[model samples]
Structure formats: C-alpha cells, structure tokens
Target: MYDEMSQLKNLLELIEEPSDINLDPEEKKAAQVERLFNMLFEEHEEHAKIVADQLNKSVEEIRSLPYSEFRKVANDLGVADSLLFKIPRLNRPRTFMSPKDKISSKLFEGVLPPGTNKAEIAMENKKSTKELSAFVSVDFDMLPNIHSSQEITAYDREVHDAIVSLYVDGENEYITNQMVYRTMTGDPTAKLTDKNRTEIDNSIRKCSMTRISIESSPQEAAVYGMQTMKYEGNLLYTKVVTGVQSGHINEWIYIMEQPILYRYATSKGQLSRTDINLLNTPVNKNAETLMLQGYLLRRIEAMKHPKYNKSYNILYDTIFKHLKIEAATSGALRKKHSKLRDTIKKILDDWIEKGFIVGYKNNSDKGKSKSLSIIIK
Candidate 1:
C-alpha cells in the first residue's frame, strides 16, 4: 500500500509536468485508473481511510483491489471516478522556454548573443536596445520563384485555382462590402458591424487552416534544402495579423490568468517565467515592461508615503501585514521576504536597458553597496 501510494504520487507528478497527455486508447484507460489511484490514495489519503472505514474494509484491502474492483468500490462509496480524474494535479509552473535548449537555439538563429545562457538571453531580449539591434541586424532571406515565366502547367493552374477557391469560399455578403470599402478607402470603421465581425472571424478561421499547411511545408522543405529562405510572405503576415487580432478577442482570458497581482499578493514577488510569458505574447512588450516598472514603483511609493520612515521599517511593516493576512504563525514571512528581495533584484537588473529603472552604487558611512531606484523620467 505504501509503495502504491508512492507510485501514485510519481504518476501525479508526471501528469502535472506534461499536462496534455496523448496516449493510445489502452494506455489512456490505464492512465485513467492510475489517476484515480493517485487522487484517492495519495492526495486524499485521510478521506480514503474514512471511506475504507465506512465500507468496513482495511486501507490495505482497498489499495490491493484490481482496477475494475476499485471502480465498483468507488461507485458503492458514491465517489465519482470522472470527477477525481478531472482534478488537476498541482505542479511547479514551467518556464516559457527550456533554459538550455531554447537559449542555444536562439543563439544559432542569430536572435541572441553567441555565448549567452537562457537567463541572460531572457534579460537581453527584454532590453529595448537589444531588441532594436536585433531588428536591424537580422537578415530575412526571400523565397525563390520556382515557376517558369513562359510555361503554364496544370500544377500551376491548380495551385492558383486552390488559392482563389479558398478566398471565394470564405467570402460573406456582410463583410465583403465593408472589406472592399476598407480596401478602397483605407478605413477600418467601414467594416465595423456585428455581421461583418462574425464574417471576418469565419474567414480568418478558414484561412488559418490553409496557412498552417503552408507554414509546415516550408519547415518540411528545410530538411532537404541547404539554404532555406525564411520568407515573410503575404500568407505569413496575414496569419500573424489574424492571430494578433484573435488574441485581442481573447484578451480577457489572458488578463484573468495573469500571475502578476496574484503572485504579488501571495508570494510577495514576481517570477521570471511570468515576465518571459508576458514578453513573448503578442501584446506590446515595451508596454508590459513599463507596466511592471510601474507596479514596482508603486510598491516603493506606498512604502515611502510619509507614513513609513526607514526603508527597513517599511519592509518589516509590509512583511507583518502580509503575515497577518496569510495567518502565517511560522517563519513564512521571513521566507517570503527573501523571495521578494530576490525577485526585485532580478527585475531591476533585467529591465535596466529599458530605462524604466536604474541601479547605483551606495557608499554611505558604511562600505560600498548597490541599490535600485525607479527612473522617474
């Protein structure tokens, strides 16, 4: 039973690490049974004992039952197997990119400095100067024109027909006129209507199906071709713009899932993963950096609002306040303070090139030290 409990915990960890499990039908069935065992024997041990006691069975007997027999027992105990299976296992949130592999890949792609680590690359990418430099330095090779100018083949006609058919099939009376008008006059408000919006959304979804195929073809071709052209074609831009617009439609979803406010309140710090995700998303990275800077500045302002005297005193008071809210009787406040300080230091160092904050040497009556301050300008 103890061994089963340990295996169950290990399975939960695996599920949490790779949240989206893709398994064969037989494997999925086995995974479901494993999930049930984990939920009952590992996560809800005390509850499992209570259920076993009510059923006049020993915990060991319950653990030793076959999957089919366990299902029967669960049903008799009025426990929903489906509900238990659906419960998400808590896991450490993964960073947006793997530190080693992703950083090395970016360096080879010429998007990062040759010798930089993942943490350093992440920090550099957040800098405005580094971004501008990359934008200017990186050269995008163009795709070759494969078709001959004089020869008109059946394949050529078929490709053109396919592209045109895709466009025609996607059209709607509602947005077509507005889209035409917008094309003519360069005014987006010409297409501002519920019917037009719905039509545009439908068109975009249909277009996306083709775009994915086209994008995948280039990647497949790269395996064979020595000098692959990383083309910024019309299709690619259209897909990118559509994706950005779709993100706007789902803005509320992202905002609700944002870890900034929650992490600030609960952990008393921001994680690097949070910042990296924010930057990687289609939303404006510069604006996000400024927003983060503003949040930190606000915290500092609150601390020095003429009510709190010494900086250390402010820190102590803030820690105590959070401790009260958390009902933390242990040394949790001290642990949280350490995390907060580390988070602040990381942010200050990374966002320095954005001109949102600055770090300076602090040499007072004591030895030399370093301190961070908000760039007020």
Candidate 2:
C-alpha cells in the first residue's frame, strides 16, 4: 500500500511551492509551469484543447512549452491564453509574490515599522489588498468521512461560513471585521448593528470551544489530510482586524495559522476536488436565508431517525423546536398547520427527488404509514 501522508505532502510541495528558493532557475521555471498546468487542470479543463485548436499544435506539444517560452504566446492569446497573467492574481492564493517566499515570513521576519500590524503588512506585501488568501493549499479528500452530530444553531453556522468563505478565498490571515458582519448577518453593505455584533461575539466564543470527533483513527485521519482540526484542538487565532477607516466600527476576526489544519466548513462554499459544493441546500417557500436554514435543520433532524429505521415517526414539531427556532418567527412562519406541514413535507419530497432519502413505503393515513427514509449509498 502507498503512504498517503508523505506522498500528498510531496505532491503538494512540488506543485504548490514551485518557486521554492532551493530549486535552480531552470528547475524553478519547470516547476512553475507544472503548477500552472495543474491549476488549469482544476479550473480550466478546456485550456489544452483551446490552445491546440488555435495553434494547430497537438495538446501534448502545447503542454511541452516551458514557462518562459509560453509567456509570449499567452500574452498574445488573452484570457483563453491559459498563462499566469490571464488568470486572476487572486487565483495564485498560495504562491506569495512578495520579496519573502512565504506570507508568514513576510509578516513575521521583519521588525514592524512604527504603526503597522500583521494585517497592514499583509495588505502592503500580498497580491491583493482586499482579500487575504490561505498560505496552505485546500485539501478535500478526508472531509467527507467526518461524522459530527452535535447540532448548532443556523446563525452560528452562518458566522462560521462567513469566516470560512474568507479562508477558502485564501484570506486565512486577519479578515476584516466588516467582512464577517456583512457575510454572516447577510447585510453586506451596512455596518454591524449592535445586536448583530453581540451575536458575532457569542458565536466566535462558541466556535472556539466546540469540537467534533473524527470517528476514524487520529493517525489515519491526519495521514489522509483531515488536519486534526477539532474546534477544541486549537482555539481560533483571532486578532483586531486592521485596515479600517477611523470612523468605522473595527473588531477582530480569526484564522487558524500554519501547522494547524482547517476543518471542513458547513457552508456550501467549500468545494471538492471535482468542484462540487457538497453542502445540502434545502429549498424554502419564503426563499429567505433564515427560512432556508429552518428547512436545512429540519432535513438534518429527519436524517437522524427515519420512520423506516425505527418504529417512531420524527415529528415536525420535534424537529422544529430542536433547530432552536425563535418563538417570534415560529408564530408568524408556522401560523397555518397545513401550510407549515406541507412546507416541511416538501423537504422530504426534495430529499427523495435528490435520492438523499427514499419513500420506500408510503401507504397513506389509514394503512401502514412510515416516515420518509434515508437512502444510504
């Protein structure tokens, strides 16, 4: 059997850090080309075919062009050029363009000049002023095997996702407080309301302490790139978000630095190797974010015990309250029993449509009625 840890590490380093200082210029150039090709392979699958058709060159021949040689051709070709410049600099999240090879070194190695912080140094040194990218590559393989049942309120998940969106965007360092408030509460343009700010503070504190278990062996999971990212493992590295206007509300945001692995985020933003966003998006009649969350929580509860597995049917009311829905919204949202029941039933219908759950035996009210069951693939 192959050793996954060492192989994945080597594969990432060779492909990720192509411009490593240790490599000679020729070797560095070759590595850079390979990494660029890999990025193209992931994002722009048709690049090879496009170039091949235009130049009347075989895909293999076009691929054979080294970094230096391809630059000239890419400039002339434009977006379909598939060159380093054609892709957004944001795409080159991991590869630091600073004088220092790594983003960490750039921030940490030098003595700070007077008034600057890490976020300030990052803005001056990094590729983008608005977004901060993760230093480590995003690993997707072991993410699916994580079995976590600890329920969290939808608000916390949103807060987590907003921060995670930053992480996935490669803003793994100091995220702006405004970014969090905007992304989490779904009021992107406006400043954080005092009520929302308190919600943020509470959620972050909870996120720091919460830990989901890895059902598999720790060593095995780590070797497979799960990164030992238990919430309780290392507290989120939070700092005052720098780079804000003096009049604006400034607060802290967090990221897990190097050596600490990031766990899978619950948000739909986390993409897999094939570019699939695995998070389940439930449809709500209201179409609002909060309403959509209610559907999601209901669906999750439904998964825990389908009537097919056990004798008892999972009650809509049981799931409704389990989701921690506030009483105020419940009265307004759940006014008509049939209406709310139909809406919740639509969740089961959608699951069945997606083949996530099954209607193995729906004998109607008089006959043998069973809950909609989960279909385990």
Candidate 3:
C-alpha cells in the first residue's frame, strides 16, 4: 500500500509539469536570444564565438572575414549597428598605415610571386625578434621586400636590439657602431675581427633599405654616396636628421614613434621578464625554436587545469588541443599538429637534459599505462 501511494503521488506531479520544452516556439526562441544577448554584452571574445555559431561558421573563419560581412549579418538579423561595434575586432590583424609610423597587411594568402625567396623572410624574423614584444607571425607576407643572405640574421637582430637599448637607456644614438655591437650583441670571449665589422656594415645596409634613407649632412651624404629617391610606396622612409650639434648622428626619426617599432604581428601581451629573456636569448636564433620555447613556457606557466601542477600528467590530446589554439594565434601557414607535437617533445627532452626542466620523465620508459606525464622543478 505504501509503494502504491508513492507511485500515485509521483504520477500526479508528472502530470502537473510541462512535457514539451518547446511547446511555445516563440518562448524557446526568445530564451535563446536572451541568452545570446546576455553573452554578447557581457563577454568580448565569447560574443565573437557566439556570433560565429549563429552564422553557422567556425570562429577562426568568422574572425578572419571582412568587417562588411559583420555589417551585412547585422542587417539580416535586424540588430543594431552597435552590436558589431561592441565585440572585439578579431579582424584587427589586418595592417594599417600610420603616417608617423607606417604599417599595412593584405588579407589575401597565396603562394609567393616569382623571384621571391623565402630565406629573405627569415631575415625579417630575426630582425623583428627584439622589436616584436607580444606577437610575431612568421610568414612571407609581412617581411620587407629586400632580400638578405641567410648569415646576416643574427647581426640584423643584434643591431636592432642595441638601437632599442640605447633609446630606452636615455643614451644618445651617437655611440660608435663597434661599441653597440660588443655591448649589445657581441661575444665577450671572442675578439671582434675585421669580418665582424664587415658583417655589421652589411646588416646595416640591408636594414636601411626598408625605409627611405636618412642623411644628416651633405658631407655625410657624399661619404656614403647617398642617392636621391623619388619613388613612393606604403613602406616607411628613413631620413637622417641633424642632431643639432657637429659630429652627432641619430639614424632614425625620434619625434612621435619609438625606434625598434614593428607594424603588426605584435601585441602588448606584457609577458613576464623571464619569458621575454628566454625568447630573446642568443642561445638559439631560429624563429621556430624561439617560438616553440616561448609558446610552451607560456602554456606551462598560465594553464589552470586539474592536471596542472609541479607534476602535471599532460595527455597527448590535451597538448594537441592547446597547440592547435596556439598555432591558430600564430597564423602559421598550415596546421602541422603531428610535426609540432614531435618537435615539442624533443624540445622538452632537450630542456630536461639541460636542467631547464627538472624531474622530467618519458612516459614510455615508465610504462605508466595512465598516459604520458611530465614533472618540473
């Protein structure tokens, strides 16, 4: 009798409740719009993803689309123009030109034109390493048109690093080139040779072509055999201005824009001093090496997960997802997940050997059937 009464009471309550959640289609749609509207106003990046979902598009593809598309979508949805304005412009990766400091980027991605060498691109990456603080995209599109030998990459980076240090230190740019090399990017153990001087000169010549050449005086112009240029393009011109004193020279403009500036592929991420130093350290000049180091370090530092700790059991799939997101941010030519995984494993192994990571282990060796894991000091 007690069980029968319990069942009878449950059946009465079941009849009291609504069986169909979407019985009111209008209410169901209203609820979804309400939820989406709340998300759009409350979160920036989330709003982008939500909008992308409503349009039946991937977040990456939607973010990369033209702003005009957003406007058109707004029209279709009967939403206010301010709706698009409120979301963070993920499409901002496109370049912009500032008269004070020039910048531009073409949205199109394609194979390089004939006569374009990819190695020349490696040169831009090396030079921009120090200048780019938050972001650096390694692709053919953003590099300067001027081609350079593979060897000059290190020297190009060094010169730019020194120029930035001088500006930040409140020191005059009139310092000798040799002093800049030794103090900034030179090796103390090895003596600077004639070859080093020639290399430095060559690097400077290549960098100068990125902008309009600047000449301080007629005498200095004659010394270097400066040529008058009239052709104009989107690239910024470098002009030498007199330092208001005899024998003083500053090669770059100093008025509004800071020296060692980069156009895009950089953001003010305000990375830790340790992260920045590791990325800029001269131990490895390869862009891939540095990017990998920096990217992994950032993940290891900032990740908050059930598995994250001094001894985190990071599974391969977890790493795959993280790396895919990171690769998206980098805008690499293609998604090389397998190669990237192998490269990262090798890098971590190397770091463990070098004492950069402590208490490291190979899951394969341990045979810890629980999936791969690593521990760090």
Candidate 1: stretches off by over 4 Å: 1-36, 42-47, 50-56, 81-132, 135-377
Residue 129: error of model 2 in Å?
A: 52
Error of 3 at 115 (Å): 12
> C-alpha displacement of 93 in model 2, angstroms?
13
lDDT, candidates in the order shown: 0.32, 0.39, 0.36
Runs off by more than 4 Å, candidate 2: 1-154, 170-172, 176-178, 181-192, 209-232, 242-246, 258-261, 264-315, 325-377
Tens digits of per-residue lDDT for model 2 on 169-265?
5455545545565443333354655555656655555544443221223442353476443322322444332111121222335354521223422
C-alpha lDDT of candidate 2 relative to the true structure: 0.39
lDDT of 2 at 165: 53
How large an RMSD does model 2 have?
20.9
Q: What is the TM-score of each candidate against the true structure?
A: 0.21, 0.35, 0.27
Write out the backbone clash pairs for model 3. 212-237, 212-238, 214-239, 214-240
Ranking by TM-score: 2, 3, 1
**Residue 114 of model 3, lDDT score:** 20
Give the clash count for each candidate.
0, 5, 4
Q: Estimate the TM-score for candidate 2.
A: 0.35
Please tell me which model should have the higher TM-score, number 2 or number 3.
2
